[model samples]
Target: MTVTTPSIAVADPVFPGRWVGGASLVLGPLLLLTGVLLRLPFDFFFPAQLNAHQHHPDLMTVSYSFASAGWVLLWPGVVLLAARIGERFRELALWGGALTVLGLFARTFHAGVDHLAFQLVAVRGAESATRTVSETYGAFHVFSTLNAAIMGGWLLLAIGAYRSRILGPVRAVGLALASAMPLGVLKGTTPLSVVAAAGLCLALVPLGVAAVRSGPNPRAAAVAGRLLLLIAAGTAMFLFGQAG
Candidate 1:
């Protein structure tokens, strides 16, 4: 008689919150890249001439629209990242997520006023209208408050991630450093700013890949497909608009 040995069972890896986290990872860089492409061609510190504005209204519009859309991905990414760090860091995650969401919402208002309203006014050659719109929308940014919340929130989230060891040291540090990107933008476009943006994009890649590799779930897969399609459609529209 021969004796048989029992086999050990290996459990499948399931990342509880990877659904939103994964989507955010996949979409976040797409949003960032689109925004950078839109901005890099222009002088962030100076106003465009009316003639220039008229000639490239579609480009401006597409860039602004896509950039604004980026936030839709970004806010969720922030929250899901916090969630991935688990319950031990719950307090930090909660505060960070709330503040980040608030800051992102404020930023959307800024984008609306600047890209949609201001662009319209600029195209029409109304200097007064542009100024009024700028000032009115500017009130919401209150740089100090908005910037602080965004930066602080990310910092806290990064710290939580580091402590939880979910993203490990390198990725956690990268995320923390990315939080400073807003400050770079505030200083106007420079070589350093471009470098910072590129670095942030690189840092986000691993997070996105991890989310994708966390194995497939029906709901997450569907959401990911929709986001991919949305990006593709938006890109196509922008290209078509530019060509026309």
Candidate 2:
């Protein structure tokens, strides 16, 4: 007679296992799209963006918040995409993923600047804020070096995807449009931004759905356990956010 034991899986920190990666893939771009759409009515420039934020603080905050959050959450999904691409084209995936992640970090860095600029509008007036930003424009920063990666990485990643056959050519092209997304502080949406977000939806959302479906079965016990863990994690973050 033999006894067999069932396995309980723990997720790695970086990869975060399949379900989270899949959710990130799906949710990140969608949230970004929502943000882009929300800002479409505004002019697409740093100065205009500053004025818009000052006049419509709440809406702009929500817009930028959603967009920033979406981009901030994208690294996990990129990791998953890179992992899949690496199975076939190791070099492409390696370079592409590294650059893409760096670019994502650049955006996170920009979000901090964007927040500062937004605050300046309330304190110093929109013109003063814009003047401040213009004065500091092109100031030296480590992230400045990675600026090209903003567009460059997506293009390479798209090529890698096509070469790996992980994504069809059309979807690959669409994925590449993410390269067109605007960068820098207090940036506003353009047609390219809309296209980029929509393209990402077309490119990644399907893969995300597929990933979730193929991932570990969410049995009742596993689901309950995960829910409790999620609640605990959220609570911890909230509490810590308020702590000394």
Candidate 3:
């Protein structure tokens, strides 16, 4: 009689990238919604003129801060989505992600300038200072460029997602539609733009949920879920701040 040898099980290769994607999915939209809601009182519009930004310094400052935070979350999500779609489309994803990140970086500058310079002008009623800041920054033109990069990047990402089958056709289409939200900036704030922004926020939820369900790392997903809960709590606090 021969003794049988025991078999050892091998684990699947862990993709640490999934964790980044999952986190991005959870945080990006939530942060964006928070940013938008924070500015609701100011009737803020993307790519708004310097004068408009100056008109609502408090709202602008808060909104930009949250929006900048959202973009920071979104950049990683973009890169992870590209990786998830696999090797064939990886280059496209990289290009798009890079452009989007750059755009978001530019937007951060815009927000900082608006928050600080514009707020100062608003508070002190300094027309000369306002002109100096506006001229120095060329704020609206920068915003226009920022919008183009973000929209173009998202459009490419949506196409890649559809092609990769990572996201289903419906969800991919939703992403494409969401990317159009940037176009609203050209029209300034309107009822339609508000609806579009809401739609974009809703569209992001499915992607995040899918990322959570498909995550290879259970521990990472759990951690992301906990973080999302914290975000929800923070959002509630933000709402309370607004109400107060």
Candidate 4:
């Protein structure tokens, strides 16, 4: 007798896994939006020119502000990858989840540091400004480095999925774009930020739409729930960014 593993192609039709992918697709963008808007205050409102000591426009605060949102964007990719290769590369999912959490941690601390840096710059003198610059840059460097690793993990997962034909080519491209995002900091411009922030963000929309139309599956229902959550969260984040 011989033992054989089940195929993931159309014959097997892993419906449950598809549901997982759908849910992630729906929720990921919403999370990204929420995180993005929270950090917009540092980017859009705070004028760097006001301070002669301003070195880099509080890059940490700005990047992590968007990073908070980046965490949300990662949900779908994480879920999709988990659904596909988790059984074989269980470590991938575990590491990917860890990376997401780590990214969030970095973002949270970075935000806190930004808060302190801002006050230091505002109330204190050039010495404080120097500290603020160093602190902000330090935080950004950490966050960017960690996030790049996370994106690299996702890209690896995406490559696995693409090779398996589980995620299709477009999704693979999106994952590749996502993997390239952390490098945006190297460019350090608004357009670069936009690419990093919202570029791959649209990749999951198709999955969301598919979930809504999927009909009568636990996975589809889950995806629908996530999609609604994302819409609400994204809206809130957007408003928060506008007001800030």
Query: TM-score for each prediction?
Result: 0.68, 0.90, 0.64, 0.52
Model 1 per-residue lDDT tens digits across residues 1-244: 5332111111222432565566676676677656656656666542452223455767766665666676556775666666655456778888877877776776675565555554565556546544554565345445446767766776777787677666556656666765665441212244544554455455555665666565645687887998899899999999999999
Highest-lDDT candidate: 2
Total clashing pairs for each candidate: 0, 0, 0, 7
lDDT of 3 by residue, 46-112 (tens): 3343355557665656665666687667766666665655455777777766766676676566555
lDDT score, candidate 4: 0.51
Alpha-carbon RMSD, each predicted model: 8.8, 6.7, 10.1, 8.7
lDDT of 2: 0.85
Who is ahead in lDDT, 1 or 4? 1
Q: Compare candidates 1 and 2 on TM-score and give the better one.
A: 2
Query: For candidate 2, which ten residues in a row score worst on lDDT?
Result: 4-13
The best-first sequence of candidates by lDDT reads 2, 1, 3, 4
| Clashing residue pairs for model 1 | none
**Candidate order by decreasing TM-score:** 2, 1, 3, 4
What lDDT is obtained when candidate 3 is compared to the true structure?
Answer: 0.58
Model 3 TM-score (2 dp): 0.64
Indicate the TM-score of model 1: 0.68
